[model samples]
Target: MQRWLTYQKERFPLLAHFPLVLLTSWCVLSFASPEPVKIGTLLLVTLLILGLFFQLRVFDEFKDYEEDKTYRPYRAVPRGLITLRELRNVGLFVAGFQLTATYSWNYPSLTLLLVCWIYMVLMGKEFFNPEWLKKQPLLYMLSHLPIVALIQMYAASFVWDLDFPPATWVLALVSLSGGALLEYGRKIRPPEKEEHGVQTYSALWGIPRALMTWFLAGSFGVFALGFAGGGWWVLSVFYGLMFPYALISALRKSALWLKFVELFSAIWIVLMYLALARFP
Candidate 1:
């Protein structure tokens, strides 16, 4: 058990928790709002989704084993912390549990089951065939948008049973742009080290160009989210605050700054929801 715990920590990392937190919070918030829905089943469904999410990480660790050896040596798979067979078993178990859990919830859970399965499939493709979608920086950046948007969409649908508002579409676009910018920023890291095995957007586009793309993408995201909530002036200002920090991170050549950008980006969605809750 201790060894398994260590493997999970090394392979999945805390970064994996962010999506679960965001999705669960959105689900709860949607339920609390003007059009409340039954959440008793939703909570259990979310737990199953999160469990599947972790299991998929194990699959990802195995799938990216080769690439990780070259570029991410610290990753658990290559470090010999876990075995491929173990990951396979875990993945199968999680998949089965996810399906069973969703089926128990009702039609809404069924829809979520399909969406989650697609996300897992995409992750496999992204990790294995970087050549297929990941090779194209723009397309790679766009890849995550659907998954993020689907989180909110699932929550809105489950809670309100209403078609997702236009604002949700705007939020999805914002997520897409931010994802693109971050990928673009990473592409330029240590520009001289292009010989490294990993092919990145910055490697293809160069630093200056990547920075331009990142800035434009970030700018559009802020504006998109800002207006999405109907100009709750304070939240709009908060959204704009992310740009300066991203710029500083650019100037200093620091990936840590990118973490800040991600944090702020996530907070924008939460704030947008809160700002909207003030009305109706």
Candidate 2:
């Protein structure tokens, strides 16, 4: 039990993720329904989203086991803090809980959950061609990013009919862009910090280009929020304030600044969801 708690702190960090998951679930529920969200529904949806992210982390551990073992031995799974078998058992338990919870609380959403599971299974397998996909980093990231959108759609399903209007997909786009922003931001590193066998956007695309891609991904999310009739001005103001600093940091190749950028990516997503919840 102690080891599992340690593993979560080192790997998942529920303290960092819970609020974001709750806000994201609330945003989707707000956008999908005109009615006020019951506390029961909000709690169930937040747990479901949290469980989904935890399962994704578990899948990543399994998928990247060999790579992490070789290049990142300090990680929890690599350092013997937790065994893969134990993690797999926990993941299975979470999956079962997600299924049963959705079935009991919102049966219609079960289909959407299954769809997300199917896509996640494909992602875990790297679409069955890991070698080819690895060679195309952009494609690999793009392929996996849809999982974020699908998760958002599933959240929406809790409050919306399966046949929701086309406009609702804009929220999915916002979610996808948020995922992209985080993916690009976290993988960026100063040139000096690049590690062999570790795939970082900064290493692959150079610091400037990688920063540009991250910025553009974030800009896309802001535009998506505006198009969806959310309070995009809030994000736009935040973006205007942050970009120059991020650009200067990247140009200076400050590792500390890179960490700031990574942190900002998470904050940006939370704010984006908050803005969405403002939808009239």
Candidate 3:
């Protein structure tokens, strides 16, 4: 049991992860509902989001089991800290719980949950061509990241009380950019951490370009928040003060950026949603 928990923390890190997921869900609540969000709705949606994130991590495990065994034997799964079969069973269990919780309150909520589930399954399959898609960074990232938007929609529906419109769907992009911030930033590892087969943005685009990409993505995230009129003061100000340093770090691969890189993504996300909830 302890080993399984440790395995999850290695990938998911609940303490660092929960607040960000909760706040993102809260932001969606604020966006979709002007009235006070029901406490029950908040609890359910937050749990669902967290569960789905874990499920996503498990999918990565399943998808990469063989790769880890070959090139990344030190990883938890490959090292036998946990087994592929165990993670698969847990993934199925989490998905089942997600489905059950989605419908327990409102049956219609199942629609969005299923949408997310189906997308997750397709993602697990890597759209049937993992190797080919891995070569295409643009397509690979764009394909996988839309799940963030889907999760946002699911969160909004918990409080929307009306049919979701396609027009308002663009608002989800604000948070989508938040996801990008994490995606790019997390993959920007240092020289020693870079793996041969693993695709780090820094490896693909080179360090300077990768950091530039992170900076730009962070800028767009703030822009999206500001454009949507959600006051992400911390995000705005952090980006404001760190813009120069972020560039320097990217350009120089300095210790400042490396130290900040690990937590910066989570901080941006937490502040982003806090701003949404504050403004909403």
Error of 1 at 24 (Å): 5.6
Clash pairs, candidate 2, are none
Q: Identify the runs in model 1 with alpha carbons over 4 angstroms from their true place.
A: 14-24, 27-33, 36-42, 126-132, 160-168, 174-195, 199-212, 218-222, 234-240, 254-280
Candidate 1, 51: how far from true, in Å?
Answer: 3.5
Q: What's the number of clashes in each of the models?
A: 1, 0, 0
lDDT of 1 by residue, 135-170 (tens): 576776676556645654554455434455545655
TM-score of 3: 0.91
Question: In model 2, which regions exceed 4 Å deviation?
Answer: none
Residue 128, candidate 2: C-alpha displacement in angstroms: 0.4
Model 3 clashing residue pairs (backbone): none
- lDDT measured at residue 31 in model 3 versus the true structure, 0 to 100: 69
Q: Whose TM-score is greatest here?
A: 2
lDDT (tens digit, per residue) of candidate 2 on 20-126: 88888888898788888788899999999999999899889999999999999999999999989988899899999999999998799999999999998999999
The best-first sequence of candidates by lDDT reads 2, 3, 1
TM-score of each: 0.72, 0.95, 0.91
